[model samples]
Target: MTAPEKPRSPLARLFMGADHTLDRLLAYWFATCAFYMASLAVLVAEILAGTTPPQAGLILIGAGMAGVTSFYLLVRFSQRLGLEYWQLALYQAVWAMGCIIAAYAITGPIRGASMSLMLVVMVFCTFALRPRQAVALAATAVVCIGVTMWCMARLDPAQYPPAVELMNFILIALGMTGVTALSGAMNRLRARLKDQKAELQKALERIQTLATIDELTALANRRHAHAVLSAEEERIDGAPGPVCVALLDLDHFKLVNDRYGHACGDAVLRAFADAARPEVRNRDLFARWGGEEFLLMLPDTRLEDAHRVVARMKERVASVEVDGVPPALRITFSAGVVQRKAGEPLSDAITRADQAMYTAKSTGRDRVIAA
Candidate 1:
């Protein structure tokens, strides 16, 4: 064993929840804040280039407003209204591309420097969008760049020379394609990792199931039975009535294995389990304790009622005939029933039940004895 989980207070929801509004905003902020930092760095670059950083005070404020407002709109409307990831990525990309282009137009002679912001935005979209959607966003950036350069060339031919604008267009095209290739590679790696994670989770569940279940009878194994008893012991006083335990043993099981061979013996045990399963209630637990024996635990059930349950099991099992075994073969079980004593370890109760089971065996096999 492990200890039970501690109860959590109501206020823990603020930070504990992953889907709660405040927690989601805070989680999103970690990624969103990086854009804010990048925008500040862009302002610094403009100042270093000896160009007037237009709206320098407003840059940080604008970055904050854009990041937060987009998230708010995405969560409250776009996401809530059930838009897809590609739609959300495209939604953010459109407005973001507009911001980057506007920044480039304002920077005058050092307009080429703003291409880095375009790279950052597209790469960020790569994580949230499909390959086709990312390509669409990149293509949109390419079109915006071409139009901005062509118009700037016409309006201010001195500041934006035709030769320089043509060269910038070539460089921007290459950068966008490089971003497309990067997104394709990332999507492949992420898909591979997701598949491996799913396989690992399935393997873990299979192992856990094997550990608790008996392979032969498909019943809870002794380890799981012990664990259940320990759990019930923790709340013995809180229960409505005493907890009853019954231990059952097949009479002369060794003779069946010896005379009919192990194959037939295995069949007999499986048949007995099938017969006994339906006799136990949903709230009660019946498990294969070990070789030639089974255990039952009934919480909040009296010893008399528990005895009746086992007697019922005994009656059902008496008529069971295993397939491929001798047709004359009859399966039967001897049982011992005991109610747990106050504050006593359940292990002790199981021992008493075992003693009573042996008493039933000695008296006449296929009978029930209460202890």
Candidate 2:
């Protein structure tokens, strides 16, 4: 019996990697910088109030320096933990927790320091945790804060006069935690939408390329070539400008496949395409017609000029080398070039070009025939 199908890994769901990783790192750095700024403000206030400034200043400075260093480290090393997404998520969570601990040590509730810990809950919800994880983390924050308040009460019972303050603190923490969870859900939704948008754009680009490109020769295929010719024909009529169409047929291509394998014949076609591609203008359209034939639309070119272009293309094709072939192995093409006549259909011009190409083939194997 077949084994049960394995689940798709988390990495499979994450399609955007290169840019997404950098974006996460940048978000971490910005959040870290904001944490440092808030911490700095607290430390400065302590100093101005004549609290022993040196110790607090030293500790705050150390924390800031460590944060800056960790920012660079996270940026560089996060990707090395590939497929270990939990590790990255944990890093973000733990980093935020460290800031909470730092804030509490220096100035607990006296300066509303413990209140800042709410930021940690918010960060967990925003960057690292899913709904369940966020709820668990929020519960953890509440428990920790309760324990601290209980300890503070036990240490100096008179200082903690009323339970009202404790209630307010708990309520504020819950409120912040809820806000963070809600915002995190929204952020996750946005991220998923962005990922979907990127995927759709990639699929559309692939479809566009497939629509225009020839499967065998990798040139523009017949459908695209015909469309381009028709468009150019219209342009010529509207502007009263010259446009040329050239039909190229391989000289004795059947003999090549008969002598060599079909693989070798395909190689010759690809080679011819590669050689011809650079010879045509960037604005010119090139396509593979049916077997052993090609069509080119040269906008703003006269028939004489188009003939010269195809002649050079033939020379390039003849120069290509096929390894493991006989010393006398060579390839050539016959081309029919025609100009768009005034007030005429583009298909007629293409037909005329085909006739001229056949005339060239009948007269000689490798020459251009212009009509």
Candidate 3:
């Protein structure tokens, strides 16, 4: 009996579950909630120590709770409300800016802790917003902080020294703008790389399809057919049933080309493929072996069963008509079918089928010979 598999790591499962955009947004919301809780604890401690005014602490707590509640509602109903990621980012940015302004008013412009938080918000915007939007947000933040500092220094000189206020404003504005510019450049570089990667993937896929598929008949090409035969031969080793390989050649194909030109010959080939494809079973493999020749591999089928399938295909081929050809003109194919013997190589089976096909051609123009 097989042993029971070990469970996946909890951390791995968590990350896998968080792969969606909504899940990541929820994660960010939870992190922000924790940060607010910690900040509230610190504010309460400062109030108890008489370092911060009770009224100021109360205001900060109220604002923090309001931000938390807004984020919670947004997270819970974002999908129902059809809120896009960019819209959510814009709302967060606006809320953050408002919170910073309120904190600056209570804590003093030059030495407010909220000034540092504003820098964090600016950096975050660089990642969430487009380059132009990020730059606009940075500029708006700088102007707002500058205006707030100027007003504070003029209306309350004791609390906000003009020299200190000016220095803080310059430092914070420069920092926010620098980060925004760098992040925008990085985002553009990343987008270019992503497009290049996608184009490279498409190129590789086209190359693979060209290599394996016949351009004219849309069937598996000679190389792909041989690989399939080899794989089937290996797979059926010591198995319960027979594997049949049939080689089919359009009888007197040159007569069509000589009579109607190569263009009509191509049409006949394509029409034969269209007629024959419906006769092939899903489990069987069919491919264009070469010019006017095709190959079929039928797993778990006997030589006689393979003969019947090819006979049906021949009937279908005869009924197929090409443009510019007379109604009296009929198309037919001679096929050779051989069941692979135990431990026999695929090459030997294919050679025997080819010889049988030649025999069928020599004996009668359109017939199936089993070897």
lDDT of 2: 0.73
Q: For candidate 3, what is the TM-score?
A: 0.75
List the global CA lDDT of all models.
0.80, 0.73, 0.82
Show where candidate 3 strays beyond 4 Å: 1-81, 109-116, 139-147, 162-178, 181-184, 233-242, 255-264, 300-305, 323-329, 341-348
Indicate whether candidate 2 or candidate 3 has the larger lDDT. 3
Off by over 4 Å in 2: 1-161
Q: Candidate 3: lDDT of 67?
A: 83
* Tens-digit lDDT track of model 3 for 1-371: 98764555678455333235466777777777786687678667767876667898788889889988887778667877898776777788777787677667665423467678877777667657889888888888788889888998999888888898898888888788788878789889889999999999999999999999898898899998888877886688746478889999998899999989999899888999999999888888899999999999889888888888899998888987789788788888888999988788878888999999999999987898998
Models ranked on TM-score = 1, 3, 2
Per-residue lDDT tens digits for candidate 2, residues 1-371, read 98764544566324323344455555656676686677667667766665524576667667666866675565555676452444555555555555554444345335354565566546555655566666666667666666666665666556553484477457757776676668667777978998999999999989998999987789998889878877776677778778788899999889888988799889889888998898988899889988999998888888788888999998888888875456587778999999988877878988999999999999987888888
lDDT of 2 at 140: 70
Q: In model 3, what lDDT does residue 73 have?
A: 78
lDDT (0-100) at residue 76 of candidate 3?
Answer: 60
Clashing pairs in 2: none
RMSD after Cα superposition, model 1: 4.4
Cα RMSD for predicted model 2 = 12.9
Sliding window of 10 residues with minimal summed lDDT for model 2: 12-21
